[model samples]
Every structure is written in C-alpha cells, then in structure tokens.
Target chain A: MTKTKKDVKLQQPKNQKYAGKAMTKGRYIRSQMKRNWVGYVMVAPFLIMFIAFTVVPVVLSILLSFTSFNMLQVPEWKGLDNYVQLFLADDLFITAFSNTMLFAITTGPASFILAFIVAWFINELSPRLRAFVTLIFYAPSISGTAYLVWGIFFKGDIYGYVNGWLLKMGMISEPIVFFKDVNYIVPLCIVVAIWTSLGTTFLSNIAGLQGVDRSLYEAGAIDGVKNRWQEAWYITLPSMRSILLFGAVLAITGAFGFGAIVDNLCGNPSTDYVAWTLQHHLVEYMGTRFEYGYASAIAVVLFAIMMGANALVQKFLSKVGE
Target chain B: MAVKKLRVRGHRVVLNRSKGGDVGITVMLILLGALMFLPMWYLLIESVKPLGERNITPPLLYVMKPTAQNFIDLFSNINSTWVPISRYFFNTIIISVAATFGCLVFGSLTAYALSKIKFPGRVAMFKMIQWSLMISSTITGITNFFIFIWLDWLNTYWISIIPVWASTLGLYLMKQFIDANISDEMIEAARIDGAGELRIYWQIVMPLVKPAWLTLLVTTFQQVWNAGASGYVWSEQLKTFNSAIATISGVSAGAASAGSVVMMSVPIIIFIINQSKIVETMASSGMKD
Candidate 1:
C-alpha cells in the first residue's frame, strides 16, 4: 500500500501535465461512473419498464397515426387522410370539437379558481377543521363512481329529483329531459365536471398554501400591504409558483380530456353530441370502430392542444409577480 | 408570560376587526362543504332505501325505513352468469395493492438515484422522464393495447400493474422531498463507515423519507383504486371493481349505490387514517418562499 501510494503521488503531476486539459471531463465522468454504479442499478428496473410501456407506446402511437390500420388488417399508408377527414368531413367530429371547447373553457378556469379559493379558505382554519373540510370537498372527485349518482338526480323522467321537484312546485307542466335534451346536456354535464374537478389540484393548492412561509405575511404587512388580497397577490402567488404551475397543467389537461364525466352523466354519443369530447371520439373509433389510425390521429391532436396549453400556462405563470 | 401577554394584546386590534369576517367565512365554508357532500350523502341514503320507497314520486331526503337489502342483494343476488361480487372485490384489492407497492418501491428507487447519486447521464435521464409526462396515457392508449397483446399481457393482472410501475408524479415528488429533507452530512458519514451504497439507501435514506413515501402511497393507492374501466382487460373473471360498478349500475340504481359504497370505502378509510401524514408531506416538499 505504501509503495503504491508513493508511486501514485510521483506519477500524478506528470499525468496531469500530459493529459489534464483533454481528459478532465472524460475522467470526471469515468470516475463518477466507477463510484456511482449503484445508482444505475437502482434505477434500472423502473427505467426498463417505463421505456417498454410508456416510451415505446408513445412512439408507436405517433407512427400509427399516419397509417390506416383497422385491427383486423394490415396498416396501409394514409398520409394525412385521417386528419383531413377529422377536420373537414366528419360532422360528428366537428360537433365533438365544439362541445369539447365549450366544456373545457367553462370548467377549466372555473375549477382552477374555485380550487385555489377553497384551498386558501381552508388554510386559514384550524388544522383539524381544515383537514375535515378538505376531505369533504375532495371526496367526490376520488370516489370513482360517486358522481354517477347525478344521473339519477338529473334523470329525464318524473322520478328524477330535479324534474320531480320542479313539477311538484308548479314550475313547469312537463318534465325536462335533462340528459336527453340538447339544451340541458351541456350545462348539466358542465355542472358535474365542476363538481368532480375539486380533486388533486385542490389538494396540491392546499399543500402549497400551507408551505408558504408565515413570516412573509408579517413582512408584507410591515412593507405596507394592508389587506388579504394584497398579501395573497404579492406573497402567496410568487412563493408557490411551481405548485401553481402544476395545478394549471393538471386543470388544463383534465378539462381537455373531460370525457368520463360526460360519458357517465350523459350518455356516450350524447344527445346530438352535446357533451361529446375528443376523448369520446377517440374511444369511439378505437374501442367500438377498431379504427386505430383515426384514434391515433385524434390523440396527436389532443397532444398538440395540451402542449400548446401548457406553454401558454408557463408564459402566464412567468408574468405572475410582475 | 408578561411579554407573551403584551404580544397577544398587540394583535387584539387586528383580531377584533376580523371577528365578524371570520364567522361569515366559516358559515360560507360550511355551506359549501354541505353542497360538496350532498351527492355522497344522497348515495348513502339511496342505497339504504328499499326498492319500494326508491320510486316515491319525490325522493325522500331521509330514508323512512333504512334496510341493508341492497347490500345483501349485492353479494347474494345471482342473476348474472359472470363472476361473483366477491371475486370482483378480490381482484380489485389485489391489483390495487400490487400496483401501489410496485410504484412506491421502484419510483422511490429511481427518484433517489436522480436526486442524490451523481452519475453520467443523470440529467438526460431526468429530462426524459419529465418529457414523458407531456405524452400522457390517453395518447398511448391504443398502442399500449397492441403492445400488451404482443407481450401476452392482455387479460392479465400484469397488464394493469406493470404499465404503472414507474410513476412520473411519484418520482418528481420524491426528488423534491429528498432534496429538501435529506442531509448530506449523514450520508457522507454513513459512507465513511464503509456502508455499501445500497445499504445506506435502504437503512438511512428510506427511513428518513417516510413522509414522502407515505404521500406516494396515498396517491398511488387512490389512483389504482379509482382507475376507470379500460379496454385492456377483457375477461369477465379479470374485470376490476370499476367494471363491476358499471355492470351493477347497469342492473339497478340501488345495486350501483351499494357497489360504489363498497368500492370507495377502502381508499377513504386509508386516507382518513393517514390524513395528517399526506398533508404534512405535501407541506414539507419545499414549495416555500
């Protein structure tokens, strides 16, 4: 050991002088690899599965979008045919797109603002009360089929809660077909969407609010901020930008992909496509029609929309403090 | 004590100004809470009401006569030729537990590597994971079905569990947590004592990151439990509780309510038990000023 140490000490300067400039980065990485091989081992299992399931499937979906593949036959090259049909020819597609936009616009901003306000309100409560109230607000979103109960509440027949009550009160002579009528489907579906939207984003916002340093409130007060709104604007918003950005992304994607709520409350291929969304279109082709190519095209469009929304959110969030 | 009393007195003016405002806010919150809880409360009320009372011209708020007949019919009613209700429950529990465990163990392992261990390709790997979040499950739904067929994972429990073994959100949360909560000095000391990296990660790192893992556990469990009925699993015996709810509801409203109650109880119980841990974990994730 002594002799090797002496030899290493004697040779270090000469080696550095000869090759240090060219080999520094390579040597650092090589040494790191030698030292931290365990990290690679630790992450290997997850990386392998993630690549196989997530990475490969995404690549395949993008590729499949260009081919006319029905599940029964080999895929033929379509070359923008699906996209053209989706935009120009398919009337159901057009209706679904409009409905999706209306649903997303109405629910996305409403739910995001509602979540933040409720989270902020809860944050001001005692710890126990805060948890209790938070759970009450959040339970519906995670209860899986909990929101399905709305189907009964808004049923079109006389037994339906809303229709029955309205009839008993002499408000209307006839029962309103809430789910079947074109005029009411979109609005009632929007109500269900908002009801279930107080989910992960709400929880994350509450967490973000609690994570804000209490000292900042006092500091802002001393800095001549006189009211709650001013403190929230100056202190809370800037402090939890990451969480806010996260909530925005979640709300955007969730609103855009608002299919299950509509499918559950209103029927799929809902009355005159009033509550139909891009996801319903995708599922209709992929699940029922077996048109993989068309579904993938819808997915690519959805991806583009989501990515564009995410970019806008990032830009808006960057201007928060200013 | 006198200084404390003086500080309390100093804030009394501000407190006095907000007393009425506080009561108003509290009342508003309570009303909103009641509205939020109405559907769930209604479901409970509906499930207990007998079929005779269910069709009353106007639905009753309180069950005139509450009975467990729906739940009894849920388990014992043998109208369908498919698997029993208990089998659906078992399948759901098994799949959810397995998937949650896999996500927690593997997600934290990858997260620890990315956040703590220095290595070549670390930044690239992290960017890859983050970018993967942009391409969501919906984008890959059809292609994933094809891959499942190729891998013979179709109609198997592995189809559900393996696809979700590595969670992007879990990894992100764990990385933030390990960065904020872990101390480098302790790890260094453990290394100097000749502890293997794996050992140090297991014995030292794992215990310290309990809050994050528990948070991951709650989220993963909730997600797996509430996964929607997908086209991936086809066999009747292999169907999840989500499918069961849809099937049961297709039969009758009372059965659907009972099925949903049973389906939702597990996660709700788990969350209620660890509510504080979940809140605390999110609070300490270093999203601070």
Candidate 2:
C-alpha cells in the first residue's frame, strides 16, 4: 500500500538537476521537512495510531497468512501450504468462496444501481421533501440491528409475520422456514441486504446528483437534449463520475461484508453450510479454533477478491456515460 | 394540464419529463420506499405490543392495548440488574464520545495538513490512508487481538475506543471535503497575517470545515455507538449498551424488541437533525481518482 508513491518520489534525480549533485533524495526530503515540519506534527497523532492499529495489522495478517501460528508457539514459516490447503484441500473453503462470490456478485451491483436509480428519482424533489424520502430508504440500513427485525418478520415458525399471514389467508399449511431453508436463506438475506444497502452510497449518489450544476442541464436542454433520459445520460452521470466510483467502493465493501447478517439471522456455520461464507470461515479458524495460519489464509483470499472486484468495477465505472 | 410547457424549477429547465414517466417513477419510489420502511415500522409496533399481542397467530399490526409495559418490563428484566441499567448507556456514551472526538480532531488536522500544506509526502500519506479503505477491517481481526494483548489493552475501554479512532473512514471524507471546499488562498492569507499553523487551524480552517467535522462526528459516533463484544473487554462494567442489549435479547424477547427500537432511534434521530448538513458534507466527499 505504501510502496508505489515512495518509489516514484525517490527516483527524483530531477532534484539533482535543479540543486546540484548535493541534492540527494534524503536531503531534498529534509529540506521539505524543514519547511513543513508543522504539517508532520499536526498529522502525527492520527498517523501514529492509524499505523499501529490499522496498517501494521493488515501487513502482519498478510505476512502471517504465509506462516503457521496456533497461538501456542512462535509463528513458523509455511510457504504456500496454507493457500494450497485452502484452495485445493479444504472443502469448506470452496463452499465459502463460492457462496461469498454469489452473495457479493448479487448484492453489490444490485445495490449500487438501486442506490443510483432511487437517488436519481428523488433528486427532483425539493430539498425538504428529498431529505425525508431519502431517510425512508436510508434509515433501514443505518438503524443498527434494526435489520434483525427481518428475523421476527420472517421467523421460521407459523407465528412469523409471513407465516402467520399465509396461514390466516389459507395460502399455506405450515410456516415456511425463511432463514433456515437453504433455498430461502440466500435469497431472503440478499433481499434484506439490498434493503439496508441503500445507505452511505445512496446518500452520496443523491448528493452527487444534486451537486451536478443546474446550469449544465440548462445548457444541455438548449443544445437539443430532448428528454429527462438524455439529460441524465449527457449531463448527470458523467458529471458525478468520481462520486459514482466512491459509491461503488462502498457497495463492494458492504456486499463482501455480508456475513454478520447471515450469522445473526441464520446461525453461523449455517445449516448444511449453505449460508456459510468466508467471513464465518475466518471466525471459525481465527476466533474459535485459534488456528491463525488458516484464518489468515481465508482473510487474505477474501481481501484479494474484494480488491479485485473493486478494480474491475472501477474499470467498468470509468465507462459510465460513454 | 400544460403537457407540452417548458417547466423550470427555480433556474434549471426540468427537461422533457413525460407525465406517465413522472407518475411511474414516483409510484416505483413509493412502492420500494414502503418495502424499505415496513420492517422498521413493524419492529416499532412489536416493541410496543403487549405480551399477549406479541404471540398472536397473525400478530396485531396496531397495538390494541397500548402501554409502556413492554418498555418497563424490558428495563426490569435485564440481567444482573444490580449494575443499574443506566450504566450500560454510560459506558457507551463515554466510549463513543471520546473515540469520536479524538477521531474528529486527529482526522481534521491530518486532513488539513494533507489538503492545504506543502509537505513532501503529503500526497503519498493521504493515498496510503485512502487505500486503507479498499480492504475490510475484519481481515485485521486476528492481528488486532494479539496487538490488544501486547498493548495490555485487553479487558479495558481502550480496547473499544482506540480501534475506532484508528479507522480511516472519517479521514478519507474529511480530506476530500477539505480539498474541494477549503481554498489555498485563504490559508495563505491567514499565514500572511502572521498566523502560525496551529493558530490558523484553530481559527481559520476549523471554522471553515464545520460541516465536514459534523459529518465526521455523526458518522464516527454512529459506528462506535454500535460497538459490541470484541472478544476483548470482558469486564462487565466496561461492556457497552450493545453487548448488554445483545445479552438481553437472548433472555427476554420483549426487552430485545425495545432494545432494537432504542438502538435504531439514536442514529436515526441524529441523522434527521443533521440530514441537510450531511448532504452538504457529502457534496464535497467526491474523489477525483
């Protein structure tokens, strides 16, 4: 994460050409440091703690993914064995990888486009009205464990809302096990995920839609932009490219981080391992089993997939308006 | 109806929006919005429903015997009632406020320096921070557990608060906001008037970035406010409202219903109050990369 920029900056023998051979990279940095020492001081508190907690841990986890550590002895080097075990040997890992992909691929794009579409629909409302409507769609996602209400609403027994209503209407004989049934669980969770998924990204898209200058639309209208659809395609989407990228990243993260809902609603290591995901796998190996090596392997794989997905979306999003 | 009229809202032309299209879009929004809204409404009803109503075959959509009884019962039946119910709120409040305040201060200062200052590695440093957002923090869970032990931070409030302040979410948005909204000329003017960086940050930059920091405040507070069992912080007194409610949910379903309402309310209420400002802050949160 920290490598590329430092490398690019260090190759600046461009400084030598300007200030004579005495201007080494180290010396040039020192001079910049002297002038901007206060900036360093100002940033130190956040930087120090961020490194200690966030950066170092990620780097350590990546390193430890290559080693065996049972929390009993010093971590011993294992080379590619953990990865091999994960990809080639572990049946559960394969289930987890596929399930996670299914969950992410379904939820991520659905939520992203949903957020944009909903926000676009509401952007024409007055500020007061827009904010209220945004909250209607937005509140479900941010309301903490409020999504758990789905458990009550979709409870497996006849007393659950759906079941109770179905029975009362004579639509079914018994309650459907919405969460426990493998077929129902994934789809139901995806529904809940999409419901709450219109969160930060949705807000950003709204803001992005609103932030597009009104004058652009006025000009587009004058320049033969015939319809609302044309105004959107020609003026709005291209204008908010950056915000769309930001929203896409959040959507990707939210989609991949789908385990907790499944865990809380359906049990962890969910029935038949049908709803099990890489997140559950990580917790099993790391939290329950204390097998750090195996857990870190899961972590690294999940990390790689999310990054790779984000990169692909970032590439796709660049072609948004065109 | 003037179907073919050129309708302008304020100054901007509304374009060629068909009546059917407008009706279709509004209807679609309301339908989906209702779906988004129903579970929350149902949960609220459930929280207030009496015990008998909670168990009914079809369940009562409206409370017939409306009472504070469920809420009263919720408080009364909490586990280890001797700890005083308010104590859980106390732990959470302190942790959230402290963590959020620290994040706001640290984040904005770093953002200002990175955005406004001419530092050698500022670009790279900010890039590093932004890239941190790419991966999930859960990937760092195992490593953080060991670090907590090493820092002797296990079973303490620091275990909860420190990690939150270390999150780069607030920093990422705040930096973008600073870059978009705060201009270099203003900082230069402040410096030309013989102000130091600290003085300028306090009097000049901080005031200018109030909306961004408020956005940071609401966002970070919402996150830390939801802190639950971390496999650290075993001490009962140090445990948060979320952990307490999590325990209560297992034992008493009614109280847990009330717990859901309480949990959901805080952030929503705060969001309602600052909804406009949050939108304003996000207006500047767009990244060019």
Candidate 3:
C-alpha cells in the first residue's frame, strides 16, 4: 500500500508541472498582446497617415516620372523622354540648377557662421539676457510678418526704406534697383535668407554650445590655453561638433529646398542669372502647364542633388563626430 | 610666503578683468540684434502711415501723422471678398487651433509611450521620426495633395490639420524631454496602483511634459497659421491672408506693393506680441541634442 501511494504522488507532481508550464505560457502571450495592443492602436493613426500621404506619394512620384501625364490627360508611359528633355533641352533646368547651387553655397555657409556667432553671444550672457536676445532673433523666423516688413525695406525706389536709408547715409547717390536688377536679386535674397535662417538652428547651436563639458574648458585652461579663441577651437568646437553638423545640414537643405520666398519675391520669368531652378520649373510645369511627367523628372533630379548634398553632410558630420 | 600670496592675488585680478575680445563680442551682438530688428521696425512704422505718406523718400522712421486707414482698408477689403475676410480669419483660427492641439495631444501621447512603454519596434519608430525630420515638406507636398484629393477631403480642414498633426519634430522634442525628465519608476508605480495607460498619461506624463507641449503648441501654431500650400489647395473659398495678398498683388506691380505691405504687417504684429515666447521655445529646442 505504501509503494502504490508513493508512485501516485510522483505521477501527480509530474502532471502538475506540465499544466503549470502551459498556463504561464498562455498568460504571457495574453498579457503581452493586451499591453501592446493599445500601443499599436495609438501609433496606427500616424502610421496610416504617413503611409497614405508621404510613402505613397514618393512611390507614385517615381512612377509618374516615367509617364507623360498632364492633369488633363491620363499618364502615358513615355519611358526616358521626360528625363531626356529635362537634361538635354531644358535651359531653365540648367539655369535653376546653377541658381540653386549658388544660393546653397553662399547662403548655407554664411547663415551657419552668422548663427554660430549669434548663438555664442547669446549663450555667454546671463540667463535672463540670453532668453531675451534669443527671442529677438528667433521671432522673425516663426512670424510670417518679417517678410512683409522686409518687403518695404527692400523696395527698389527711394521710397523704399533700405534705399532711403542708404541715400541718407550717402552710401549711394540714387536708389539701388534691388529687385529689378539681376545682379542684386540673388544677394538680396541671400540677405533675407540669412535673416530668417535664425530660426530653431540658432537656438540649437546655443544649446549645443551649452552642453559642452566644463571640464574640457577647465582642462584646456590648465594646459595654458590663454584666450577664448583657443578655448573655442580646442574644446567648444570639438564638443559641439554634432550640433554644428546638424545645424549645417539644416542650413544646406533649407537653402537648396528654398522655393516660396524666391517664388514670391522674384516672380516667374526669372529675371537674370540662373534664378529659374528645378523647383521653379517643376512648379511651373505642374501647376501652370499641368505637365506632371516633366515636373516629376525635374523633381527627381532635384531630389538626387539634395540626397547627394545630404550624404556629403552626413559624411562630414561623422568625421567631425569622431 | 607674503610675496607668493601677493603674486597669486595679482594673477586673479588680471583674470577677472574684461578682455578686449569680450568687448568686441558685446558690440557685435548688439549690432546683429539691431540689424535683425530693423526690418520689422520699418514695417510697423509704415503700416500706420497714410497711403500718400507711404511713398516718402527715405521712408519715415516715425509716422508724423499716424493713421488707421491701412487697417481699415484691409478690414473693408477683406469684408468685400466673395468669401468674407471673416471666414478666412475663422478658418485660419480653426485650422491653426486644431493643428496645434492635435500635435500637443498626439505628440505628447506618442512621446510618453515611446519613453515609458518598453515594446518591440519603439526604437524603429523613433528612428523613423528622425528620418522624417531630415526630409523637406516640398518632397511630400504633391503627394499629400493627391492623397487629400483621393479621399475627397480636398478643401476641408482635415487636409490641413491631419498632415501637420504628425509633426516629426514635435514628436522628437517630446521624446527628448520625456527621456531627460520623466522617471520610469513613477510610471510603473502608477500602473501598479491600477492606473490605466491613458490615465497615467493624462495625470502624470502630461503635467511633466507641459513645457515641451507648450513649445510644440507654439511652434505648430506658427507653422499652421502661416501654412501656404494646403491653404491654397483645399479651400479656394477660404483664402489665407498670404493667398489673398498674393492674388491682389500678383495682378500688377503697383497692387503687389500695397498688397505686400498689408499682407506682411499682419504677421509682424503677431510676432511682436509673441516674440518672447517664440525665442524661448526656439532656444530651448535648439539647445537640445
């Protein structure tokens, strides 16, 4: 009777272990699904919207480049014709390409440098003053009102504030024809670009500067670094390298992707130089001429240029980060 | 010992003295600030001037005779538009408010979840948000437009509010703030106390993330309020201040001048009122890694 009882107890223990394992596994799966289900649901709206708006459009744009579709007609497969026309025959494409490069090269670096200087100053100030100064500089970028204000300032005639101020200061004998003259247009736009570029990047730069370890500065000082310039070069610059790189990328992309300001200010029939760039061509063809295929081709080239620029910047940033 | 002490004290005094470089920095900053503010100042002065007074050579710094005629003209002209200016204002208010609120609510929620909830694909989601930040809206503009048309959502507030609601930058900002500030233990404790995810988010996370939420709200408001493309696309009937100015001015150079002046000033006025907030938010965001 004792032996029989022992065998039964041993069998009962084995059976209970298997059942316990199965139950825990089932519970684990259930709880995980329950916990994560809401998260999935929460992110679903954004994911759906992104796929619908961004992902689908990008894919369609690539496909659309191969077809000759004006808004009025069905998109017909044109193979390489749209691409050929943009590269081979389009003078405006070339002009826009050069103009965009010019804008990007001149404005990108200049804005970054200016912003860095401003950021450095703001960061060095007392907390109260820093806040106040930052607000003054950043206000224009957020507020669309700066453009309106700048419009009056850049008026071509003597009545224009800038021209008037220049004349009063004896800087020029006559009102400078700023907008009408092609030579002046790009430069004028660059000025405005820099003015507005003091947006979030400037703040970021300041933040970046602030995040630099104080120990590095103290170490440099102990090592006989005599001046702010030396301190900045040896410590500040290296520490804030990532932020600087990020700011530079933002500047470059912004300068290249610029459209609205130039479109609004310069108008179409790009006055002189290479002001008629890819963005203008694309907008003109798509919006006015309704030529979707041609526009897509232009966009493709623009996208390539932007991607190349971004790649170069990323490489530079990685180098700096190291 | 006395001689060594005197030498050390002298060295400290020399270090405390303001350097020439510091003076140079102060001057440069002041000049830059002035340059930055000049255009807006010029615009404010011009806006209050009589139309005839507007053409003065070397535009007046201070209007000798201030007039409300420009504002009056703007209001009356807006009233005359087929879709009354009031509707445009109402539309702008609704769209900007909705978009701002949406970003705040959705951005904070997603940010909180990403920061607190340990789930698969969270890192992937964060990375995707960063990638989106790098790509300019221009690339997505046409795609967004077509999508809206397909949904038969063209000319509706949804077209404007929906796209902007999922602001990558806002989400990133919120995530950064939560990561830096919020403690996981606090959230877990709340969960243990039988608090639902939404309840904890509202009661705990939301309060903690107020600063980030406000920053996103202000930034999103500015972007949406000045939104140009969607406004032009969806509702031709509800023209924004920008489009209205563009239409009137694009017809002729003379009209363009007057239209530009009026159109530009409205934004400038808003900037003046919110200048301090704008700066603080921008500075805070920019400072972030």
Q: Which is the leading candidate under DockQ?
A: 2
Q: Which is the better candidate, 2 or 3, if ranked by lDDT?
A: 2
> Candidate 3, A205: how far from true, in Å?
5.0
- Candidate 3 chain B lDDT trough over 10 residues, lowest sum: B1-10
For residues B111-135, write the lDDT of model 2, one tens digit per residue. Answer: 8888888989888897787667776
**Runs with alpha carbons beyond 4 Å of true place in candidate 2:** A1-30, B1-18, B78-80, B183-196, B199-211, B249-251, B276-289
RMSD over all Cα atoms, model 2 = 6.2
Model 1: DockQ against the native? 0.43
Q: Which ten residues in a row have the lowest lDDT in candidate 2 chain B?
A: B280-289
**CA lDDT, every model vs. true structure:** 0.78, 0.80, 0.68
Best by lDDT: 2
The better-scoring model by TM-score among 2 and 3 is 2
Give all TM-scores, in the order shown.
0.87, 0.88, 0.79
Q: Which digits, one per residue and each the tens of the lDDT, describe model 1 over residues A1-322?
A: 1234554565456356436466677776786697789889998998898888788888888888999998888999899998999999999888778877788789988888889988988887777778799889888887778888898777788888888889999999999988889888888888888998987778767766775666677666556665676777888888877677667777887888888887767767787777778889998999888999999999988888878877887898988866
Query: Candidate 1 versus the native: TM-score?
Result: 0.87
In the order shown, the candidates' DockQ scores are 0.43, 0.46, 0.30
- In model 2, the Cα lDDT at residue B124 comes to 89
Q: Arrange candidates, best lDDT first.
A: 2, 1, 3
What is the docking quality class of candidate 3? acceptable
**How much is the lDDT of residue A29 in candidate 3?**
53
| lDDT minimum window of 10 residues, candidate 1 chain A | A1-10
